[model samples]
Target: MALHFSRDEFASRLELVKARMKEEKLDALLIFAQESMYWLTGYDTFGYCFFQCLVVKADGQMVLMTRSADLRQARHTSIIEDIRIWVDRTNADPAQDLKNLLMDLDLLGSKIGVEYDTHGLTGLNARRLDHQLTSFGTSTDASYIISKLRLVKSAAEIEYAEKAAALSDDALDAALRLAKPGANEADILAAMQGAIFAGGGDYPSNEFIIGSGADALLCRYKAGRRNLDAVDQLTLEWAGVYAHYHAPMMRTVIVGTPNDRQKELYAASRDAIEAIETVLITGNTFGTVFDTHARIMDERGLAKHRLNACGYSVGARFSPSWMEHQMFHAGNPEPILPGMTLFVHMIIMDSETGTAMTLGQTYLITDGPVKSLSRHSLDLISV
Candidate 1:
């Protein structure tokens, strides 16, 4: 088996899920989230755009239902032994096939937990699945069950995260070195991505968020290219993926001397991150950390420029977004725990001045002071 972790590790993860299933009185878990499958059985594949399901029974048995193309993929990357293939046709109902498989397992009329909040399980497929299970079994939304279980990092997982963090620092260094007046934004992006691949890193869950001037104020990535301004600001946010685990980093680069307002915002962002770090310990609620970050920025009169939340959980993931369901949002009552990895970014954008300053890095919560994953300096870079 070409599993990422040892057999014992995989077994431990399975037991964790089964324990949760027993607590919830679920007979089986119909997993549609690609990340959940990867975490449980080392099942790695980008073919989740098509219909797929990994069924985990309460007793410990596991089965995968996917297209014929992914049958080999399951064997090569996962520990799942019972693989069933559904044929492709003009009008194929994989959901029906899943129901048939459940019936074969004698789990019909039993309570089955389904992951409803993922791209792998689209609304159409979910509706079809519900219709198919109407007569076979019961399906309930248990998306957060597996997700919450994955928040705490194992030793082996932390190794991958550290490697990813190193690659992120390297990529950001390349970006800062290549970012200068007259440099093309696209070329700068190319340099950073190249640095990642050259350092043996994999593609991130989302495209690198790279922008300059007014575009920097916006958070998401957009197409097109423009030369760097002689005295402009550039913002970048990207992650390094190692064995599907991600450690993201963010920074805002100044090509020349920044204005007074920009300097003030950058200082506040730096101080806010430092202050927030002091409170990231086991037993503290995430809401408290977020509130501390907000108060620091709000007290600096940058409330409108700052974001509502500062960070979220990071882990092995697939496309669209790297953010896990666990987040550091105001009023959230979830308590921080050891082994949790969070990417906190102090993003401040003065829309009127068209200035953006973001300083962020990943951290691992320990028993005492949190450990920073990236070695990059927290100060805003000025070239």
Candidate 2:
């Protein structure tokens, strides 16, 4: 099936890049990174090395250069104006081609921004290109220019995201329902994986997180063979990929009814999530959510830094980026914007009572407010 967006939707995306290029004062932006490529072209071939390096001219001319092998796929997938294929990846020397592409647009005298964070400049190709260019520049995060353009969802993009959200919802429901007192973490993970695939999702960016009991304090707890104890707390988080877009979600469930301490912590954490959800807005900084969540945990004497990850970028591919599109993994004071995707996972653990709990949800900044992509509840589930 050929999934396509309306012409107006596509035009908005192109305009977005033009606006960003003007802001950055760069002639044309070069993108070799998969996340950036997917964000601009909406084509995800899952090619680590075979994908094209794209250059978006400030005049609204977008050109993508990929390896010869990917020419067919690139031609079919790109929704842009120009497609250039490099017939050779190695000895043939595409440096001149890149140099020529820049020279054609009078970019030799202009600034060229390269994404070093997502696509590093440490390869033979980069060195060769560096030698060929008269003037070259690089930055840690090109996502700033990219995210500003990608944050707002068009009507068609929202339709795909909605479908992804439904798939994630069904998968989470399956995992929660299948989770039981004697079930192992592997069992839960497998069930969720099956459900996600069954629901029509293609890939998961990171390994699915299915932490249990005492292991809840550990962030990104990978699924293991450990059987769920009667009182084990299970934290579930995974993102679904459809046409390269991400619909991420997380859920928390206990093997059995929690103790008083566990209940209190769960209540506090849920309160934090709800509070953030209510107050989250386009102009609000991600720090706002983190600080408020920290306060709820502080009052309960829970270690805030124990599980320290606020949220990250959600877009065409699962880069797990922040709202600000920061190059580094640190707090960002940038205000949220519509179409920006972020994953906020609030967690709590009390080993004294042998209970660990957490909940995560992805939200898209909207015109009026932030909307939850993960429609699941915050209530602690007991299987």
Candidate 3:
């Protein structure tokens, strides 16, 4: 098997899940999140776009119900032994197949925990699942069970995260080398992604955010690429992924010399980020970090240019997004625990002056003090 973690580590993870299940009085857990499956059993596949489920019973028994296409995929990549394939046909009902699997496992009339909040379980498929299993037993929305468990990184997971951080630094180096006047956004993007791949990194869960000129104010990835102007700004937000663990970084680079507004924005961003770092400790909550960022930015009279949320947790994830459920937003009570990997960003986009400045990096939360994952300097880059 092409397992990324040791069998003992997988077993320990499974035990943690079961312990949480016991606390919640869940007889079985209907895991639909692809990341949860991979974390538990090294089950890797994109076949989760369809109807698939990994059933984890309280007794430590496990079974995977998936399409025939992923039968070998699970066998090769995962440690799951009892794999059942549901046939595909016109109007196939994999939910019914899942019900049968539950029956075979003697889990009928049992309280089950369902991972309802994930891209792996589409709305249509979720409706079908509810329809088939509604009367089977009690099902509760326990989506956060595995996600909360994954918030803290293990030693093995930290190794991958550190490697990902190195790749992120490499990507930034490549981007800076080409970030000059008349440079193509496409080429800069290519060089950045190429650096990650060439450094033995994996594809990120989401597309890298790249934009230049007036579009530099955009935080999301959009279509069309343009050449850098003699005096322009380029915004980039990307992650380095290794073994599915992510270490994301963001920056708005200046082509040629930075203007007055650009310099002011950069200073505010740097100040806010450094201030946020002070409270990124064990006692502070996620909301505390954001409040610090907000206080600094608002005091500097840049509240209008700042985003609502400063940053979020980053770790092993599937396609469509890299952000974890826990985020650094106002009123969030999630504690800042040690062994957690978080991405903190200070983004300032002034459309009034058409200027953009962003500074971000990933950090590992510790008991004493938070540690930055990236080795690159936070100084503003102007090429």
Candidate 4:
């Protein structure tokens, strides 16, 4: 098997899940999150876009129900021994197939937990699952069980996270070399991604955010590309992925001489992020971090330009997004724990002045102090 984690590590993870399941009175878990399945059984695939479920019984028994295309994929990449294939055809009901699997496992009348909040489980499929399970078993939305467990990184996961961080720094180095005036956005993006790949990194969970000129104010990835102006700004947000562990970084580079507004924004961003660093500790909650960012930005009179959310937890994830469930937003009660990898960002976009400034980096939360993953300095880049 092409398992990234040791069998013992996988076993430990499974035990943790079972413990949580027991605590929640869940007799079985219909895990639909790809990240959950991969963490539990070393099953890795993008096939989760379709209907697929990993059924885990409280007794430590596990079964996977997926399409035929992933039969060998599971065999090769996962530790799952009991794999069941659901035929894919016109009007095929994989939910029914899942129900059959549950019946076979004698879980028909059991209290099951379903991981419904994920990209892996589409709304249509979720409705199908609920419909199929009606009167068969009691189901509860326990989506956060595995996610909460995954918030703290294990030693092996931390190793991968550190490697990802190194690759992130490398990508920034490559991007900075080509971010000068007249540089093509596409070329800069290619160089950045290339650096990660060259450093033995894996493909990120989502597309890198790359925009220049007026589009620099955009935080999301868009379709087109353009060359850098003689005096322009480039906003980049990218993650270096290694073994599915992510270390993300963001920056809004000033292509030429930065204007007064840009400088002020950058300074505010830097100050806010630094303030956040002091609170990203074991005692502080995710909400506290955001409050610190908001306070600094609002005090600097840039509240309108600041984003509501500061950042989020980063970890092994699938396509569609890299952000974990825990985020730095107002009033979030999620505690900041040791061994958690978090990306803290300060994004300030001023549309009126047509200026953008963003600064972000991933950190490993420890008992003593948070450790920066990226080796790159936080100083504003002007190329």
* Clashes (N, CA, C under 3 Å) per candidate: 0, 6, 0, 0
* Model 4 whole-model lDDT (C-alpha atoms): 0.93
Identify the runs in model 2 with alpha carbons over 4 angstroms from their true place.
Answer: 1-3, 49-51, 87-97, 104-106, 119-143, 221-224, 318-331, 349-354, 367-370
Ranking by TM-score: 4, 3, 1, 2
User: How accurate locally, in lDDT, is each candidate?
Assistant: 0.91, 0.66, 0.94, 0.93
Candidate 1: where are CA atoms >4 Å away?
A: none
- Model 4, 1-383: lDDT tens digits are 79999999999999999999999999999999999999999999999999999999999999999999999999999999999999989999999989988999999789999998999999999999999999799999999999999999999999999999999999999998888888899999999999999999999999999999889999999999999989989999999999999999999998878889988998898888888888989888999999999999999999899999999999999998999999999999999999999999989999998899999999999998778998888998898
Best by lDDT: 3
Off by over 4 Å in 4: none
In order of appearance, the predictions have TM-scores of: 0.98, 0.84, 0.99, 0.99
Candidate 2 is scored at a TM of 0.84
**Candidate with the larger lDDT of 2 and 3:** 3
lDDT, model 2, position 216: 62
The alpha-carbon deviation from the true structure for residue 134 of candidate 3, after best TM-score superposition, in angstroms, is 1.7
Stronger candidate by lDDT (1 vs 4)? 4
Model 2 C-alpha lDDT per residue in residues 83-201, reported as the tens digit of each score: 67666645676766777777776776777766544532337766676677645443223545775566566666677677777777877877877688787777767877787788777
- For model 1, the run of ten residues with the poorest summed lDDT: 374-383
Q: Which ten residues in a row have the lowest lDDT in candidate 4?
A: 368-377
What are the per-residue Cα lDDT tens digits for candidate 1 across 300-366? 8888988899999999999878999877889988889999889998899888777899999999988
Task: State, as a TM-score between 0 and 1, how close model 1 is to the true structure.
Answer: 0.98
